[model samples]
Target: MRQVVISKAGSPDMLRVVDVPLPEPDPGSVRIKSAAIGVNFADLVGRLGLYPDSPKIPYVPGYEVAGTIDAVGSGVDASRLGEPVIALTRFNGYSEALCIPADQAIPRPAKMPVEQAGGFLVSYLTAYASLVVMAGIKPHDRVLIHAAAGGVGLAAVDLCRVYGATIYGTASPAKHDFLRARGVQFPIDYRHQDFEKEVARLSDGRGVQIALDPIGGRSWTKSYRALSPTGRLVINGVTSLTPRARRSLRALLRMALTTPWLRFTPVRLANDNKGVVGVNLGHLWDETALLREWVTQLLAWYDTGRIDIHVDRTFPLAEAAAAHRYLHERRNTGKVVLIP
Candidate 1:
């Protein structure tokens, strides 16, 4: 077997593919012959050493995979062999074959492609947790989604469309048409225009009911201000911290010095009639029952054609570094997967 490891935190070049002994499943676990591995922005953050929760260096960085079960350990059902499934691997998902607890592997929809299944769980789960679970989204609500063309952003757009919410998404000008096609009614060019002003103008100065912000730093302040009274703001990621492929202490210090951290106190919330919350899928691993519930609902939506998973690019496992660079450059409009 082969696995991609982050030898040391630096640039994409730090991702090295090396041969490793094939892993055998322990009791109550199963081995998956990975067909496709999901590439997420968090993986990039892990490689840059910006993610505090990331494991020590010289580790594999992958969260999800879709593949076929070829082996099972003791106490596992032999019938599960040859089953096509999607598994959530907190780490070590970059290998050609890996072992995971059998319960973590969910059966893939019969009609869904393996590539789509590979990228499904994390993005949709994050979006579902933020939009439906946290915000309690309702019909006809005006919503603002930053990075609207990215994986989680697109998943949020699809869910908002299902709930009949009008969407205002921010993206580069090149992805504006793509965002519009994905149900974003107003696509603000974040590079060229002020999204806060655009949201106010587009909503006729009323502002949106919900704002999903993943690009943390000062963007959180703007997203909060773009919200209407009683509106909710969900901060999910801090991509702004790693503006480049390599770690730069100087850049990190500058961001900390320039960005104002808003205090959301009880009085502030009561006076403004607004709410702020955060969602980190990585931290929710222990809430197995909750995750299973959300995954079940999401899979049903996929089966019924209520939502769609868009995969923008697929890279060979050996080109893991290149894959990271692609995501770092913000060139992919949807999920990026790696073939093992």
Candidate 2:
């Protein structure tokens, strides 16, 4: 088997491919012949040695893959042989093959494209946990989403549409038309305009009922200010903490200075009748039942054509370095997949 190994935590050049002996499934596990792998910004953070949940050096760093069952272990059903599936992997998804617990693998809609399935779980599951589990989004509720054209941003846009929410999404001016056609009733160009001001203007100052912000920093306070009374805010990531290209003293100082901006007290939250929740799927590996349920719901949505995901590009496994650069530069409008 072949897999990309993180030679060290630094540049994309540090990621290189190497041959390793094929792995066998442990009891109750299934081996998947990798077809496609999903690349995420979280991968970039891990590669930069910034993610606390990251494994040690010389490790594989992917979270999701989709393929077919090549073998089964004891306690697994023989009928699952050759089954087409998509699964959540701990950190070994950037590989030719992998063994995961049988229950972690879910049936991919036969009609769904393999690349889409490979890139689905991380973004959509996080969105599911945010909207359904945390916010309890309801019909006609005004929702605000930042980075609205990115992978998880697009997923939340579609899911909010299905639930009949009026969406106000923040993105670059270039993405407004693209997002407006999807579900975003209002698209705030973060580079040129103030999202807080625009959102308040659009809502007549009543504010949105639900806000989803994965871009953390000073933006956290802004997103919180855009919330209505009793509204819910879900903070899922902190891309602003690290520079995309390389480490810098200025970037590190900025991160430190912005730290106090995201702080809030439980007393303040309760007094205002507002809610703040954080979701990190990578850190919730032990919450198996919840993960399975979320995956099941997302697959069902895909089967019904209610799940819409755009594949920005696909790179052959050998070109992973180039792919990493693309994501690090934030050039993609949606999912970037790697074909093995």
Q: Please report the candidate that would top lDDT against the real structure.
A: 1
Candidate 2: what lDDT?
Answer: 0.87
Clashing pairs in 2: none
Go through the candidates in order and give the C-alpha RMSD of each one to the true structure.
1.0, 1.4
Q: Model 2 off-target regions past 4 Å?
A: none
What shift in Å separates residue 2 of candidate 2 from its native position after superposition?
1.5
lDDT of 1 by residue, 238-302 (tens): 88867778887877887686554655778888899999999999998767788899999998888
Among all windows of ten consecutive residues in candidate 2, which has the lowest summed lDDT? 241-250
So what's the TM-score on candidate 2? 0.96
Model 2 lDDT per residue over 95-166, tens place = 999999998888888888999988888889889999989999999999999888888999999899889999
